[model samples]
Target: MLTIEQATYDAIVAHAKRDHPDEACGIVAGPEGSDRPERFVEMVNAAGSPTFYEFDSTDLLHLYQEMDRADEEPVVIYHSHTATEAYPSRTDIGLAMEPNAHYVLVSTREHGNNDGPVEFRSYRIVEGEVTEEPVSVVDAFPR
Candidate 1:
């Protein structure tokens, strides 16, 4: 299961809704080897396509460098589906490079930019295999 803070979850949903019609993509970074997702970093969708999303090469490089300096690693890699369910596509499966990261998919098809709830799902993709995981939202992380 992927446990996340309520505020972080809300922010991700907001970002997805804000980028409706174009898939939104970003990541949450935490200390290396730690599964905690404590920092949210919103990223631009280089592809800017409703059916696809990509991070700008330079931006991706910079993000990795910055994370390295902070001794952080991406704990969550997320994207939104504008027209489909919150499930990984073949393309997504092929692009799963972080075996230890939680892959989050949010579908804005049902609600679009409305106030209605979206379909939020998480999965673990490793070596072309996708395994669904449960999500737990909490007020905050315990020390």
Candidate 2:
């Protein structure tokens, strides 16, 4: 299961909603080798397409460099689906290079930019294989 804090979850949903018709993409970073998602970093989608998302090469490089300095790794890779279900597309699966990261998909189809619940789901994509996983949202992580 992918365990995330309620605040982080809310922020992710909000970002998804704010993006509206375009797909919102981001990554949550945590200590290296740790599965906990601690830092939420919203990213600009270079593709700017409702059906696709791409991280700008320069921005991605900067993020990685910063993460390296902080001894952090991307624990969660997320994107919003404006029109489809909260599931990974073939392209998403193909592009997933992080073997240990949780891939999250949020669907805003039911209430585009409105006040309503969205379909938030998590998955594990490794080597082109996709596996749906359960999510646990808590107030905070235990110290």
Candidate 3:
């Protein structure tokens, strides 16, 4: 199962809410350990609609450089689903680059109306094949 901290989950939800009516994409950065996954918002260029999502290479390059400087690699890649369910679309499978990296999806269907309750899930895309896994969001900070 994929694990995430409260902050990371909050960030992703905020990003998805910010990009409502369209898809938002980003990357999750963290150490190899499973303590706290530091998720970052990479630029996502909408395919002129909510049905499609394309990562902005220009922004991705900047993120890559930042990660390189930090001596860290991308642990997971994230994108939001505006209209459809939080499942891997055909295009998502086609654009799978790192099979090892977790593919995170935020579902804004019926739930995420406006700052709504969003569902988070993780997936693995290898060799044009999609394998989904469960995600558990643990609150890093106990109240």
| TM-score of every model versus the real structure | 0.99, 0.98, 0.86
* lDDT for 11 (candidate 1): 93
Q: Per-residue alpha-carbon lDDT of model 3 for 5-119, expressed as tens digits?
A: 7778888888887887788888887654433357565566646468888876677888888877876677778888987888988889888887668899988876554855887
Ordering by lDDT: 1, 2, 3
Residue 22 of model 2 has an lDDT of 97
Model 2 root-mean-square deviation:
0.6
Give the Å error, residue 132, model 1.
0.3
- List ranges where model 2 is wrong by over 4 Å: none
Model 1 misplaced regions, further than 4 Å: none
The all-Cα superposition gives candidate 3 an RMSD in Å to the true structure of 2.7
Assess candidate 1 and give its TM-score to the true structure. 0.99
Give the better candidate number (2 or 3) by lDDT.
Answer: 2
Residue 64 shift from truth in candidate 2, angstroms: 0.4
lDDT of 3: 0.77
**Whole-model Cα lDDT per candidate?**
0.97, 0.96, 0.77
* Model 3 error, position 111 (Å): 4.0
What digit string (tens of lDDT, one per residue) describes model 2 on residues 77-101?
9999999999999999999999999
